[model samples]
Target: MASTVVVIGGGYGGISVAKALDDIADVVLVEPRETFVHNVAALRAAVDPDWTERIFIPYDGLLTRGTVLRDSAVRVRPTAVELRSGTRIVADYIVLATGTRSPYPAKLDVEQAADGAAKLRATRAELARADRVLLLGAGPVGLEFAGEIKSAWPDKAVTVVDPAADLVSGRFPDEFRAELRRQLGELGVELVLGTSLRELPGTDPGRTGGFTVTTGSGVEITADIWFPCYGAAIDTDYLGPELRPARRADGRITVTTDLRLPGQHTVFAVGDVTALPELKMARAAQAHAQVVAENIRTLLQGGGTLASYRPEEDAIVLPLGPKGGVTYASEVGVLGAGPSADLKGGLFLDMYLELLGAVVAR
Candidate 1:
């Protein structure tokens, strides 16, 4: 019998690995969402309603011979993946690539693309009515959201509240940090770092209303709308205790150097579900796919040297909007808006379309 590789997740890493092994192996991709969400562009979608449609791409045309299971994985055993409907898919190898979730606007809570887009449109209406926008969380999502909001409505007052004293400081270079602050200032975004809100808003986030929040420093600020941009809840409940033993305390899985779940060559994990001491970004997940793909290929070929995976260099291409952002690479160090926009600002949709071969997330 031919080898069967079941991939449980249709996110960036899952899609890439499944596509790579489409014809060579009996690839089975299991996921719940109707389409692949280009989550990196989510903030932009929140501000630019027209771009919302492009953030979701169906999985219809992604694989040539591999099967795409449009269902949820309820339990993953050693050799089979059990769905919520109790259907079991026996596999020679399994790839656990289930990703995480973020706040709405940054990530929609819906399963279908249309519903997700509708939510974005509704939030856009709220955003348009609100004058003062408060963003809680200073991570990439928050910063990027502030940039998107400002880029769309330059006159709107945007405040970003973060508990960290510096922007991704200590992780990257000082020049990178300085440039980020400079760009935020140029865009008229106010930063209230080193503190947090004394109390969360009485109203729900992403809702339109008038409310004032007190900060830990006793500074009072009122806003018509606010959004919580941080918090990444990983999806891993499907793994029973036997499978759950592979997961770390943070809900991420412990993988071998070759990306396989320890003690089980037939099981592997990747993407936001992996316990890598790096920012949970799409790029890192894609890197995980490369290693997992190679390792699986070797095992299928009757065993060979499995490739090892390590954190890639400090590389990031953070888009502020369609026209601005920041990026860093070992080849170029940290760069300004021009390079950032050139790499990510323009190619966001086209790149995903190319990845999935113009398939809808169906």
Candidate 2:
């Protein structure tokens, strides 16, 4: 009999490993969502209704021999998984890929694809009616959202406010930050850094209404709609007491160079949930998936050594909109707007669609 591998969560890393192991293992992918949300394209979907439907791809064709369980994990054991539906599945190996949760329009909180798309359409309508917009974060999410808004409605005023004095903190070079500001300025995006709102806006995010907010520096700003674009927390509550000890104070799970839990051979983790010292991006998550898949495949085949994953230098492919943005890689430093747009402007929607074998009517 083939080895049974139960993979938890259907995010970027989850889907990649599941697909890769389907041919070799009795892959059982457990997830609650009815479709795979291409969250990389979520910001564009919020501004363009055409992209709303394209981002949510059904998981029907992801596996031919494996099974896709429309359920969530309630608890995980060393060699078994307990589902919320009261079903217990025994496995030779297990993978935990539950990623992080971010603010709306970047990562939807809904489980079903239709519901998520409806929320995006509603938010798009709200954006269309609004004039001035206030985004509360200068991070990548906030900057990308501002870019999407400006691209869709260039005439509308878009302002981004963050408590950090600089954009994209960390090892990113100063040239990258300066170029990012240049592109955002070219798109007429206003930046209010080194300060934050005294309090949140009275109007709910993605809704249109007039509200004025004061900054910590005593600066007053008015806007029709406001969005909080920061804060992403790991999702790992399903880990039982046996596995819970592996989680750090920051909520990220600890894994070895081979991406396995400490002292465990059959259990592993990947993506943002792992305690890897790298930016929590989809590309990095997928890379983790590749490493984990290779190691598992070798173990199942009975004698090869497991592969190790090393954290790469900081890299980013931030697209401002369909026609603007910036790209950064440690090897090549930072590229200008043209390369950024060409690389991720369409948000890699087609690539994901093809990966899952999702067919959409053009």
Candidate with top TM-score is 2
Query: How accurate locally is residue 254 in candidate 1, as Cα lDDT from 0 to 100?
Result: 85
Off by over 4 Å in 2: none
Q: Model 2 over residues 1-362: C-alpha lDDT tens digits? A: 99999999999999999999999999999999999999999999999878989888989989989999999999998899999999999999999999989989899999988899899999999989999999989999999999999999999999999999999766898899999999999999999999988899998888999999999999899999988899988878888887888889888999999999997888999999999888999999899999999999999999488899998778998889898999899888899888888888778888888879889765
Q: Which portions of model 1 miss their true places by more than 4 Å?
A: 359-362
lDDT of each prediction vs. the true structure? 0.86, 0.92
Error of 1 at 275 (Å): 0.3
Pairs of residues clashing in candidate 2: none
* TM-score: model 2 vs. ground truth: 0.98
Superposition-based RMSD of candidate 2 using all C-alpha atoms, in angstroms = 0.9
**Cα shift from native, residue 215, model 1 (Å):** 0.7
Residue 211 error, candidate 2, Å: 0.5
